[model samples]
Target: MKWSRAVHHVEELARRCDTPSPVPMLPVTGLWVFGDLLGEPRDLDWAHVAVIVDLPVDDVPWLDIPRGGQHWAQAVRLREPLSCLWRSAAGPVWNHRIVRPALVWDSTDGVRESTLSALRDGLGHSVRLDAPTPSALQTQLDAELAVSLRSLRRQHRSYDDQRWRPGKLTPHADSLWRATDGYLDLLDAVNAPQ
Candidate 1:
């Protein structure tokens, strides 16, 4: 989907927050728990949830902490930094409406299967992030995942260059549009140029 469509989906996702969901559906794939320590990967609890909908800009990372009743759908100008997940230090926190900010946004289905649980178990609590066998944790990623990851990386990079930027400022309807923006293809995304 284009920029406008992405925003529309974001709002739609927020309204559905009352509906229970395990893994993030379609466009919403990245979610995390807000814990005692802000930005600590170790503190992620399976209980906390919320997914990020990628925006057109990569340079500006935005975090929207819902007030009392506000939701992700209501979040304005969404961009989250690709780093440690954090809970808001101040105010009443909405459990699942917030997400970990990431620069390298990985929304592929394979990532959801592999790492989603690790986050649930609390990455820092169960797994030794700096342990020698850290590589062992990533053994699940296969060629298929690699292609999808590569494709998303390229799409993000393309946005980095204002020249190739594809998202429009206003709403543009395209039935063929997608949150992945035609980038999640297995072969084309892999072979496509950056």
Candidate 2:
């Protein structure tokens, strides 16, 4: 399924669940609703529904709102709405289709996951997001990570070259580069894969 279809299905699901209609944050970015608020899950009788965008592997954003919180997985299960789980490369990993009773993604037989109600509860709303092959997904992830690493390196260089210039400078730049360097090192480890 394309990103447009994914957004459509998720929007329909939200309305059918008696939740507020989704408001698109951007024309092609993603959609959000009252349920997506970070507070209590049952507020407004809403379940936090997150319709994450599935873009080309290299175009995926580094920061994804839906996947950010510490208790994100728990939130997904507790919220009980259908989730379009995006894997590493903005690939549609789950709930992109309604083929099984309990919507599962990433791998078959890996885990059991579902919503509290049946697919019929969606009020006839359904769709599928065409997902990429595993190798294709991995290539996308690698490309994004490589680009991110290079960008971070450039930032480090800018900070180093500017911080001690002939004029006065703020101390924040020191801490900024320190943090960036640490994160860059961590990404290096992740990119190495072994």
Candidate 3:
């Protein structure tokens, strides 16, 4: 269940299932695998596979997806894309999960590289999967993730409570809530360091 193995596992499954990888389409700047694969190698076991897309992910026109390997793709989906503006919501988790392991990235226009660069600046450092993990970096990241999970759990509970209240909800409220629940479960599962 190491990083490479997990990626190979999913990829092998995709191959066996004859699933083609996706191509980032118009309005979708790029795609990159993120998560345990980007964490420390020894701590890379038991990962929750996820990717980031530039555009609003749901609006991404998938030219192709690993259809045969739809289960994981559908389950975790993504944590959503990061924005270049530091003032915007969704700050870094302090690692390569923010931007590396590029899959369909085309920085010819510099958009992809710029956003990632901006993110690194925001975090005050760069975290790269290709490089060796700095001492205790994994521990620091785990603590960061723990804080994120705790905060999300609180928000999710509040969301659930609001769902049952006497009020008219948006047409996609239930579906959006379910997606958030699934994401929370995925985060909860792979929050470990080893």
- Whole-model lDDT values for every prediction: 0.30, 0.36, 0.36
Model 1 residue pairs with clashes: 1-178, 1-179, 11-73, 49-96, 62-79, 81-101, 81-102, 82-102, 82-103
Alpha-carbon runs more than 4 Å astray in model 2:
1-61, 64-128, 165-194
lDDT for residue 194 in candidate 1, whole number 0-100: 33
Query: Top model by TM-score, which number?
Result: 2
Question: What's the C-alpha lDDT at position 143 in model 1?
Answer: 38
Q: By TM-score, rank the candidates, best first.
A: 2, 3, 1
Considering only N, C-alpha and C atoms within 3 Å, which residue pairs clash in candidate 3? none
Cand. 3 Cα-lDDT: 0.36
Q: Select the stronger candidate by TM-score from 1 and 2.
A: 2
The residue ranges of model 1 lying beyond 4 angstroms of the native Cα positions read 1-16, 20-72, 75-133, 140-149, 156-194
1-194 in candidate 1: lDDT tens per residue?
Answer: 23233323333333343243332322333343233212333322232223443322221112321122123333322232112222222211121223232111123432322233333333423322222232332321223334334545644454455444566622222211222443333245334453
